[model samples]
Target: MMGNFHIVSNNPMVAEKYPDLTEFEKDSKVKDIFAEGRNSIHLGANLINHPLAGSIKPNQSPYKSLVMSNEKGELDMFSLKLIEGALQVLKKFPPRGIEYDEQTLEDFQVIDLDLLDSAIDSLPYEYHE
Candidate 1:
């Protein structure tokens, strides 16, 4: 459920849609988001969705969003490994050197939000209770 999760993202649309649930890092890069999620995982939070979920390559999108459990307990090894691997894979792709126009940037934000929404929608019904 929405209340059980935390959103780490640089996408403004996601923050706007779920302000209370988001850890909005307006200036963070994709790797920054992944690293933040990894840090949270180290603190015992689990990943609710893959960091690299969509078809858009890491280098292609300027915005990234990750959903993680709000509850902290024993460290989640799976989440830690996943986020760490994502960070490593991200290092392989060079940054998008080309500057995007405002419209293109907004489109990227929409795509990131859509992926996050999909993950939320796929959660089991009991989690929403």
Candidate 2:
């Protein structure tokens, strides 16, 4: 099984000029809170009292190792599993280095936008089981 995540951001300037994304942001509450709490732990005591924290931490958990976990716990079995998982990724499929993106920002003015559109639309989509 393979999991892939892609992030495509619309230009904020484009939306500002056109005003289409403003409605979406308004409805989603995306812009309402730029950040949630106090900037630091010393100042964040009040914000730390959320009910979600009660059930989120598990006993003898991985959080104890890397997150809330002590240093000794991290050097134990959990590190073994972490190393194995990383090795699996490397063994199964190593990363490919980019070899073909020679275009510079200056080359953009000469590029054909229609060809770019056609190339994007020509790719076939595959569904994972």
Candidate 3:
């Protein structure tokens, strides 16, 4: 059986904190976690943009949809460890915009919400029809 581990978050903190989980996977601890039967782990700024990535809101759902699997896929202890490791890295960094382009305002959205609205409104009026 083959499976994959993915970490997706709109939070730019991910990019800033742990730029690459693949690099961390090289660590003995990370390797041991995925020893079970996982294929790969990835980190991204937007989960919704990825083909395999989806968003899960705790209150909106019965369970946390943080992880996903193929029809026959599942996450094991190793997967949890991988998430933990990534989270630890995020905690260390603490989303302070330390790194250039790390979690920029654009990631969250422009400073002015109305600017976005104006841009959207400015789009070809014919499209509305």
Candidate 4:
């Protein structure tokens, strides 16, 4: 039943009649997708940092206490930047509406990925760690 309608059609009347989705919702959707992307990248990061991970004490899995001595550290910097960029994207395209609903996700699609990608790419390749 949900898929019965022409959601993305150019029909002016249909678009006019349908409930409008907000920019905030659209931004939220992008953030959700970006988060998923960040997670996937983190998995890759974990693999890439396997050697460093191995060095950590077995009792300490997630390094919350990693003290960066005068040197730069090898951490989840890439993932951090990805999330930051994603947040910035949402801010740049803040939801035009005050709130969101289930239908909002269905009503929107990613219009741009360049901004988020650039943020992620801007992070340094390696740190002093």
Candidate 5:
């Protein structure tokens, strides 16, 4: 099954501007965490902890993806069958690439739970199902 994951942007500036993201510092426990096989970049904590816990390979899908929170408010919001669940959030906050190396910063992203809570509230029931 496809696991729940975050739509990480290589750019920290995006996270800095948005309240949803809290930047990772270089000394953080997860400072070195990165999507394996993919170019190293900032990873959202919500993305790193939940679905990618046992991740062993880079996503092979041609399309980039994200996983929204489920009705129970868990990040376990998507699998292969529930891809449509993340579409709306993805549309509104599409991930972007950075112009510099990601290792330069620290805080990956501690999801603004409040923002995610609200976003999850607005998604259709189908998204949670």
Candidate 6:
């Protein structure tokens, strides 16, 4: 990942792995994270990773992580549009009503973390910090 970007995540594993580079939102749901990303985009941060990256649907996983530009600049229409689309997709899926067990929750966290790692790994190494 580039040094100019930062992560916004509701997954504890992500927060633990990249403490300084993450804006951790404890106990936040997937939609909440997307909303936060949308808010950041409105404030001029561009989305670095797609909000709906993994195979896990919004209702399948409780955790979410997104990367965004750290520097605030002029509004990015692409980022705004992407985040809005994500929010709309989120609304299509009903909530995961059933409460997950501890192990299941941990599994969800691992999946989210893995997806985040993939995004970070895909970035060019030249600007990594």
lDDT of 1 by residue, 1-129 (tens): 257887999999999998988999999989889989988898889998988955888889999999988789999988888888888888988876889999999999988899889988898764464
Candidate 4 to native Cα RMSD, angstroms: 18.6
Ranking by TM-score: 1, 6, 4, 3, 5, 2
Write down the worst ten-residue block by lDDT for model 4. 60-69
Q: Output the worst ten-in-a-row residue range by lDDT, candidate 5.
A: 56-65
lDDT of every predicted structure (CA atoms): 0.87, 0.23, 0.29, 0.30, 0.29, 0.87
Q: What stretches of model 1 exceed 4 Å from their correct place? A: none
lDDT of 4 by residue, 52-106 (tens): 1223221221111111112223546654574556446445653454353534422
Models 1 onward score TM values of 0.93, 0.20, 0.25, 0.27, 0.21, 0.91
TM-score of 2: 0.20
Rate residue 129 of model 1 by lDDT: 46
For candidate 2, write residues 32-106 as lDDT tens digits: 211211111122212111111123222101111011111121134433443344334334543344243434311
Error of 6 at 77 (Å): 1.3
Candidate 6 residues 5-120, lDDT tens each?
Answer: 89999899999999888999997878899999999999998898888955788888888999998778999999999999999989998876889999999999998899889888
Least well predicted 10-residue stretch by lDDT in candidate 2: 60-69
Total clashes for model 2: 3
Higher-scoring candidate on lDDT, 2 or 4: 4
The clash count for each model shown is: 0, 3, 0, 5, 7, 0
- Over 4 Å off in model 5, which ranges? 1-111
Clashing pairs for model 3 are none
Candidate 1 whole-model C-alpha lDDT, 0 to 1: 0.87
Minimum summed lDDT over a 10-residue window in model 6 is located at 120-129
Note the residue pairs that clash in candidate 6: none
Clash tally for model 3: 0
Per-candidate alpha-carbon RMSD to the true structure: 1.5, 19.4, 16.4, 18.6, 13.2, 1.8
Q: Once model 3 is optimally superposed onto the true structure by TM-score, how far is the C-alpha of residue 122 displaced, in angstroms?
A: 41
Candidate 6 similarity to native, TM-score: 0.91
Scanning candidate 3 in windows of ten residues, the lowest lDDT window is: 56-65
